[model samples]
Target: MASIQLQGKIFIIGEIEAMTGLHIGGSAGELDIGGVDKPVIRNPLTREPYIPGSSLRGKMRSLLDRHLNKPLRRDRPQVRVHECNRLADYKECSVCQVFGIAPSRNMEDTMPTRLIVRDALLTAETRERFNEIDTDMLYTEVKTEVVIDRITSAATPRQNERVPAEATFGPLEMVHSLYTLDTGSEGSVDSEIALFDTVLMGMELIEDDYLGGSGSRGSGKIAFRKLKVIFKSRKHYENPQSVPIATLAEGDGVSALRKADYQSQISAAMQA
Candidate 1:
């Protein structure tokens, strides 16, 4: 069971089907050639649309890299795009390679990785307190805290209005169900967390279903259930300094814990 202790709330933004002015089926002028469904489409059962983490992460990283005036690296591919391929052989394509695993045999039935946004926060008093410390040390600490907060809050899109809205879904609308953590760092975390809290406070949790078809004709639907957020410490894990965002709920901890205990067993079985 691989467990991560998160210290903040997990906010999910429901997927909205963007009207791309594109239609499916093969037809020049009602020709008899066979046609297929749309690509980058959502699966009906899951209601939630599939946006590869690679897509989201890549876009964000590019924007961030551009803002920072830094040259981007070729090695670190975006997470969502990497996971887009369903074929086992292609699983090593990029993002899925992180877990060192491929999509299940029934790729359509398998759950696509839920996109998550993590928000970290700190008290106002804490920020001022740190300012009194030595310049170099204080600056370094602040930078670290900023990076963590940026990573967690990276998922929310700034051009939200341009995209379709998910209001009909009730409290879960625009809400995402994911595991979150608020590692105590500094005031940097507070600002980021506050931003998410404000954005998700009144969103509805919708249960609409959408069909997600892959390039290989593999397809599945998604239905969102509950939406929740959790907070915990990084000190609990073996790699105390690292942060993790999970897709499972707190109640699902038992299964996750068991999996952590026998990771080798699970990995072996998965490979077999």
Candidate 2:
């Protein structure tokens, strides 16, 4: 009998505070008249903040690999058409075929190519806060949906390369979920931390769509965006410790905190 193959999917759940900026296109745009410009309006019912899908997908992929203890294959050529082998091949068979290069000449190293984050929600706590505010009432949390458009990248050619790489995945779809965060609550930070730690400590990338739903209130969905993967697990040595920087120097203070302890802090606060 032929050898049977088994595949496993990993599922991860966590909260991400908007670190940069985020924006969604309105239903319409306006032209400047008399030295003044009016912005387009969007549907009031579906007022969901836009979180880039690339952001979610990239983070998830990193967490997934950490959980699985498997390093992604990164040495493969960027041009897929020039490469005959698929990402699955490396996952299933550990084989990669290079186009215009002989099989023997093909590099043996493999890196993760497809990192997807589908059916994601913008922290449930964020949604609940939005709901608590009267339609007529506005709050800063409404602006809590960070504007991620201008979050600049680090000064690294590889980091620059991946930004475009992530864009190739196409527009992403955003979904909303109900997450709770209480001020003066114990273990809040810990709760988030625990959740993130759990995700990073797991293996596999599973499918989930808990946030995608349609109700009488209409569809509550998030926006989706794509990003390129120039490099994964890039590391920088600082103070005698090696830090994993997704895109070179992008792993500074806050980014490093997110990569290391932010989730745990949230979890702890939630628990408190």
Q: What is the C-alpha lDDT of each candidate?
A: 0.28, 0.28
**TM-score per candidate:** 0.26, 0.27
Candidate No. with top TM-score: 2
lDDT of 2 by residue, 1-272 (tens): 12211111112223333222222222223322211121112224454433344444443444444444544544557522123354354433211110012354344433222223553333444556655765321211112112244558433211000010011112232221112232323343233224333322221131221111121122222222222111111112221144332221122122232354443322332222
lDDT of 1 at 244: 42
Error of 1 at 227 (Å): 13
- Candidate 2 clash total? 58
How does residue 86 of candidate 1 score in lDDT? 52
Per-residue lDDT for 1-272 in model 1, tens only? 22322333333422222222111111233322222112222324432223443333333333333433443334446532223335553332222221223444345422233234321122233335534665322111111111124656654321001112221121222222222233334443333333332222111111111222221222122232333333322332334345444332322112222222222321232222
- For model 2, the stretches where C-alpha displacement exceeds 4 angstroms are 1-4, 24-45, 50-55, 58-116, 131-272
